[model samples]
Target: MDTTSNLEEAVEVLQQLGLKEYEARCFVGLSRLHSGTAKQLSEMTEVPRTRVYDAIRMLEAQGLVEIQHSSPQQFRAVPLEEATETLRDQYDARVERLHDALETVEIVDTDDESSVQQVWAMTGQDAIENRTNDLIREATDEIVLVVGDESLLTEDLIDTLNEVGNGVDLLIGALTETIQDRIRVAVPEATTFISGLEWLHGENATVDETAIGRLLLVDRSTILVSSIMPTTREERAVFGEGFGNGLVVIARRLMAQGLLTVRDPKQ
Candidate 1:
């Protein structure tokens, strides 16, 4: 006889897989015995014999149980790992098909002339940096950056930039001497520039006329920008990737209007 608590736990597992109470109990009884006739399972699990046959048939249809055409009929549970793997494979296939369909739809919609601004928020320094690094890896043409303060610079970000190869152009707005040293040491081949940061300083705005902000642009399309001071409070950043209101549009404007300065690659 199955213990009451073991029956309860078995019922819970079945329910988690979308089985009703009666069906769960019947399946649990069959699983515990390895293989049993419907009448026998009904007696052990306390399910009515009439309901037990139907539950076994339903479980067999779901590939969770197998049936034998012998006297009184028999049912057996599939091995747990095999059942789990089969369900997982089905779920993965469905997801892959859905993703493919979405990609095809996106290709058609991308042809339409439209502007969109989608905002994404991520908390914690590690998550923010990870998102930024992913954007960098996807950069095929260029990457832009603006820094409000140098304190946010870390070895991980610089290391990712260095390893990204020569396919991307790296641009920067304004950064401190120490931060510049870090970047130079990490990525000696990177092209960097400084301009338009004077807007940040109220009085010294004239001394250093540059923009004070942290904006990362990838592939002239995707952009990642942050406002939080990673040193003071729990920092957050936004990552936006698409055609409209992103690197493609904004970086073009910055380049055409001379709002940005490009560092000489030779130096």
Candidate 2:
């Protein structure tokens, strides 16, 4: 590891790609030279001269190195572009094999899948956004979403909202009129409103208290409510799917705050 930062970094990356420590060092050492002998690779990489030959043989088997059988022996790494492509293909193949191997495992859950109402918790902004978009896509009758923060109006969410089928009713509410206006232009087909939920961003709120993030009610059945935690400002969400479930019912009421009467999900 007592080498140039760039060389050390290259060796670390190669090891992460499934190369052994000595193999990575040898491959990286050879990469810097058009051709190198065992002694030269050992001196450059700090790997034992005796181990260099073994590492070179493994690298050659993996199509990362080419060996010239001279009296002492010579080794050269494959061209950088070709070597990268080979590694990528190898990594992809390994991933595919792992997926295939695990795909056949049977679920061991003893409880019936639908016997009880289930609520799952999720964290992270990207994950919450993806789950919200998925719920929107699955809506057959209605998709009601309330944005508590303007920052959550990402292009991906807008794209997902715009892609909703014409047959589905799409209602989007923003905490402020300006955000509502943006939503209106971004998705003209949807009805946009300025939310009446004052608690989402009350005047007394401070950095120590959690803030409302986003609320999504799809088909009046599936519900996702996320909150931004204090201090770190990390997003977390709880998702539940079931018509007439308590969580779903509460979300429906909350999202339909400004309306005179809440529409029945079944209707």
Candidate 3:
């Protein structure tokens, strides 16, 4: 790229790094010249003479530039490597302070049972996956999962299941042997079972098939039912908690019935 293009790009980058537009332009101008008076910098960078002083003051405060107290007061950009290292150090220190502050902050306390009693609709694949992962990680006793779509079995979900300290029962349906193998390898502690019921009629069933969804019951208290949209292929989910919640009750009963159905065919 040409020198003008390089200067513009550098100014943009510096602005993103917390410098104002005038500061960025002034710094770039000074860096190219090694050192210059405010008037010279204003002319080279096209920054107004009035704003150049303000920008120079900011750069001096940030330790990115040095000022020589002469008749016209010359300004020099700090050595590039030193200026970058200073910015990195300041960034790291701020991040560390923020982390420490957050660690001490108390999260708002709410009654989990009452708070999650209402069914919440979650749209988008990322939202569904994140909510599911949160539910899985919060499970303390057991997790019952009914998987009807292999696409929903993400690596992060598998890792979360593997990390669960309690029991996990997985009922898988309509997945290829390879996908099933991947799940088994990732979540070795889970008791795997093949779901006998075929929610869809044939192998060519599309995502629109009502059967293309998954059920999750966490500690028999929280439940999430999710499906993949046929057209957009985006995932959607309804989740809720509370022992007496209607959705929770229905999910519990359905899971129980599924287990019994898998265990006994004559019934």
Candidate 4:
């Protein structure tokens, strides 16, 4: 993208990672320079000159910026590689802390177990992917995944599939042979096949239709199916756990075609 857009995106990302606007702006400004005075950084980033020092100090404390001791203090972001690693470590630590804190927060128990199965709906690509990965990680017996769209075969999903413990079968189906080959190469242990689920990419499919994204069935009990909205391209999914769940039945019915047909292919 253009320089201005890149700078804005960088500032936005840094802010999301817990940096204040001024700190993020200052860091982005310094990232483009070897070293610069507060006034120069202010001019480049549009952060007030007086506030640049505050931002610089905060960034320095976070190990994102290095300040030179001089008459007019010079500031610069840490090397890109170093800065990235630092940010990753910080982000991971924060996530760990959040996990720990959340784990300790007692859940208020409501209703007891019911005969009815519950299906959960969730939005956003990252959250869906995380849920899929979590299901894969938790799989003890088998993982059956149908990739309706090739883009859903992300590196994180590949890694999770690869990490499935021994004796846990991994069956991955793709709508196209090319994606099957790609999956086989990336995950040698996985059984990859061309899915018989042609309706996922049927000729009748149009721009107005909600496109299938990914289908994941773990241990024959849990199921997650995501679809991409036609206009927004945003992914939304409904997941259910329990062998008796209607969604589980749907997952089995949806995946039976490919899995049942590929007995000799990868067996």
Candidate 5:
């Protein structure tokens, strides 16, 4: 109801993230204090004598408050701009370490299988495309693509893929008329299909000539199969290497035996 009540709630949320009650209180109280001590802070912020020392200690540790330790510690808030800049540096370092640890865990050793291949799961649209392009650029022989349509692929991305040239055999599934025309404009050399692939019709795409969803085969070693939300517009694609179970194994076998026919788009 009270407009200031919303800001009070936000301050509580920040306090929960590790800000001390006295630190939070002192920081908020400081704007009112202009500068104050344990007693003044206690009076203004409604903090108690028994808990003030503990609160001051927490605030001091956070660098949000400075302590002028005399008979009693006089506390004052660090300037807001300085406090924020200090916190940003601390948080950035913690985040960098976390990212390094996650990247290290991408490959794990399993007792059941030899370490010949690795599979990774990439989330987000940009991440999926980056991993897909990595596979294509790394490919020595071919790149088999089963993508949704041209609307999904931007003009710039298409240009980069086209640089792969004849070394990449692009097998594309156009989910709609829009995709087919876009594909033609993007990669005139790619093999195109209009039938058995699911989810194409809603986008006005022709069905695949074979049963396929989103399958991208990279030089017969890496594969990505996407799962689309049947109801929503969002889609997720999973990337796997040759040594995994289920679809990875089956697709790898198909690519090995040359069963998934590689016909030229010209045909």
Candidate 6:
């Protein structure tokens, strides 16, 4: 790269490593020249001569540059590899300090009755998917899932359910034999049932004549219900957790009453 382009790139990288703009520019300029007086560095880069000494002092404190004792003090950048290693170590140390500081702060405990009973609404497909994945990952014993749209049964969701193994009870409405076959292949250990829920046949039916969206109950304590709008590419979901949450109770009862047992041939 040309001198200007090379300096620009180096300054960008150094700034990302937590150096100030002037410090980055000066250090890069000094690196290029091997050793240079502050005046020369300021002229080579965009740093003003007055600011060059301050930037060099900061770089020296960070162990990135060394100053030579002479009539006009010269600054030399540490070797590139050594500089990068020093930056990495400083970055890691800062991260460790931040982690320690965060641990010392008090956070509200949300596992109690009041917090768990609060229903939260989430919009957009990505947000709903992330919440669903979090529920799946946190499920300790059982997961009851009722899917209205086959498309909502993404590969990542299937993999997560498969990882949880036999504790998952899946009830999918209006699935064809082909789609059922795909689910079987994806999660071989889970009990997959076909639900004859009435919603699958009406005007409010999801795409492909399935039920309207999905209902997920994790360990019977957490519940999530989502509505899918295929034409508009919109998704809305509400979720809450608690032992006696009304949503969780209703969803569990609905799944038990509406779902029909489908015996897998292998089982």
Candidate that beats the other on lDDT, 3 or 6, i.e. the better one? 3
TM-score of each model, paired residue for residue: 0.46, 0.66, 0.53, 0.88, 0.47, 0.52
Residue-pair clashes per candidate = 7, 0, 0, 0, 8, 0
Candidate 2 stretches with Cα past 4 Å from truth are: 1-102, 112-116, 202-204, 259-267
- The CA lDDT of each predicted structure is 0.66, 0.87, 0.76, 0.87, 0.63, 0.75
What TM-score does candidate 3 reach? 0.53
Question: Which lDDT value does model 5 have at 250?
Answer: 67
Model 5 stretches with alpha carbons more than 4 Å out: 1-112, 115-120, 199-213, 230-232, 243-245, 249-267
Give the alpha carbon lDDT tens digit for every residue of 182-251 in model 1: 5666678775544354443223444233323356766656766665542455567666666666544664
Off by over 4 Å in 1: 1-115, 200-213, 229-232, 246-267
Top TM-score model:
4
How do the candidates rank by TM-score, highest first? 4, 2, 3, 6, 5, 1
Candidate 4, residues 126-194: lDDT per residue as tens digits? 999999999999988888898887777889988988898888888898888888889999999988877
| lDDT: worst 10-residue window of model 4 | 258-267
Q: In candidate 1, how many Å is residue 63 off?
A: 39
Model 2 clash pairs? none
Clash pairs of candidate 6? none
Give every collision pair in model 1. 196-210, 196-211, 197-210, 197-211, 198-208, 198-209, 198-210
Number of residue pairs clashing in candidate 1, backbone atoms closer than 3 angstroms, sequence gap of 3 or more or interchain:
7
Pick the winner on TM-score between candidates 2 and 6.
2
With candidate 4 superimposed using the best TM-score fit, by how many Å does residue 248's alpha carbon deviate from the native?
1.5
lDDT of 3 by residue, 1-267 (tens): 998899899999988777889999999998998789989998998999999999999999999999999989999999999989988887788889999999999989775556645998888878788888888888776677777677778888887777787454444332445655766777777766555445522267765564446788887789888877777777788988888788988877766643545532112
